[model samples]
Target: MSKMSASNLKLLQPSPPQDGLACRATDGALSIKTVGKIYDPEGVHVEALRDCSLEIAAGEFVAIVGPSGCGKSTLLNIIAGFDNLTSGEILLDGCPLATTNTSPSPGPERVVVFQQGALFPWKTVIENVTYGPVVQGVMSRAEAIQRAREMLSRVGLKDIESSYPGQLSSGMQRRVEIIRALINNPKVLLLDEPFRAMDTVTKSASHQYLLELYSATGKTIFFITHDLEEAIFLADKVMVMTTRPGYIKKTLAVKLPRPRQYAMLAAPEFIAMKADLVGAVHEEAVKAFEAGEREMA
Candidate 1:
């Protein structure tokens, strides 16, 4: 997908801060304090988020779920420094993230992977993977290529290093995008429904690959997805958001053991967790649907 499409999709669209949590900004991790976002389109003010707060531990994987248009993407954009929050602050490792410093700019410690793999079609796979490190001057060209090749091999994509993005399958392309972001070793990785468009088998494969990468890298990740099962299967904690003017409704811890497998989805604990989350999400979904109906009327 083009950058324009990604932005349009995002424009069309977490938790309470507490002490003692390793994710707490006070503990030198990621923190969100009463963050809010509003948009004025043609004099109509739309509130997207309200008093949203959440803290993620240094290496925690948190998956956020909410009704469509609940500002899940908006939250990700703010965390990524792509957009400014109207109210509240976001801090990374105890430092507030400046809203004015846009991404791919200097001193951005976060990288985002959109639903559509944002790859430069003209650049070969290796070049795309190494782009961030090269641009950020994080490593020399030779070192970047070496690191990219190693990451690709770890994810089983080493053989396609010379191919253009157009030459790879959708799944492969997504993996390349992930490697591209990961190569920078950013402190945080923001994923906006990266697997939503893939086939089930492909999505499942991507999930396992991501878990492996997360285990190896220990990078904190904020993942947004509408899939309840996916969230439970992949995240250390699953955060549910309410309808428009989104806020954290609940946070559920997934106790399933890792090296997680698809089979675990059938386990009693997994099913129970999904049941509770489904109930929470359904309540907000109803509210969102009613709000839309009223708006049309």
Candidate 2:
């Protein structure tokens, strides 16, 4: 079989992300109220999220948990300025979020580490980590290099600065992505299942590391995940979402003592809390499934 010519293949390729880098700015608290999203013009409008209202404090770690297709990712995207709300509003501190087509000024305070790591394969680890600071014009070449190295060390990847993404494991790749996100000292870290591909052991370790990062930097985190245990372990406040056309089913404050350990997972209090969350989420999941069935019918 003959390969397509470069000229012919160019047109078939997808356009790359505009390669904009977010800078660090004072990230105000995130507030969403009665926010709804509907994605249909002529068909039955499918609501990905409905009337979801929540407030994440400037330095709190909040975990969003729900079943598949529950709009967890959708909600995160809305806050990230990647999606639009059909009704209601999202505010940062008190200012409405910037969602116009123009790339907002790079605010080093809010950074998102997508689930896929989304690293550039051609770039070495140092380059990948340095991309954010470099693009934001925050540091000189030498300064950015030093900052990148420091971030890599913080993530336990100091010796692997020259490694390529393809050479690292899924967990390692995630660390690189995280370090890149944090190099700018973002105030609010939006993580969309950053550990979905890791092994259980790796996940646990990464979880602890993340908590340490949270405590050390006081960086507010809005994390989305389907794993109940993971949410239970990490969040200071766990927000449960209903299934499709998701809504906030419940928001439970995890009063579990911090500096947590594995023993907490096996305790009755922990188990009870987990059960309560599961029950709350289960109600929404079932309702969502039935709604889908009715729509199909």
TM-score of each: 0.88, 0.85
lDDT of 1 by residue, 1-297 (tens): 111222222221111212433333323268888988888889999999999999898889999999999999989988876677788888788777844343313243588898888999999999998898788775789987887886676667869999999999888898899878877756788899999999998888888778767766667889999999999999999999999898998999999888788899999999999999999999999999999999999
Highest-scoring model, lDDT: 1
93-183 in candidate 2: lDDT tens per residue?
A: 7787743333334355678888878889999999988888788887777887886775566556778889899999877788788778877
lDDT of 1: 0.81
lDDT of each: 0.81, 0.77
Error of 2 at 23 (Å): 13
Q: What ranges in model 1 sit over 4 Å off? A: 1-28, 99-108
Cα shift from native, residue 14, model 2 (Å): 35
Residue 176's lDDT in candidate 1: 90
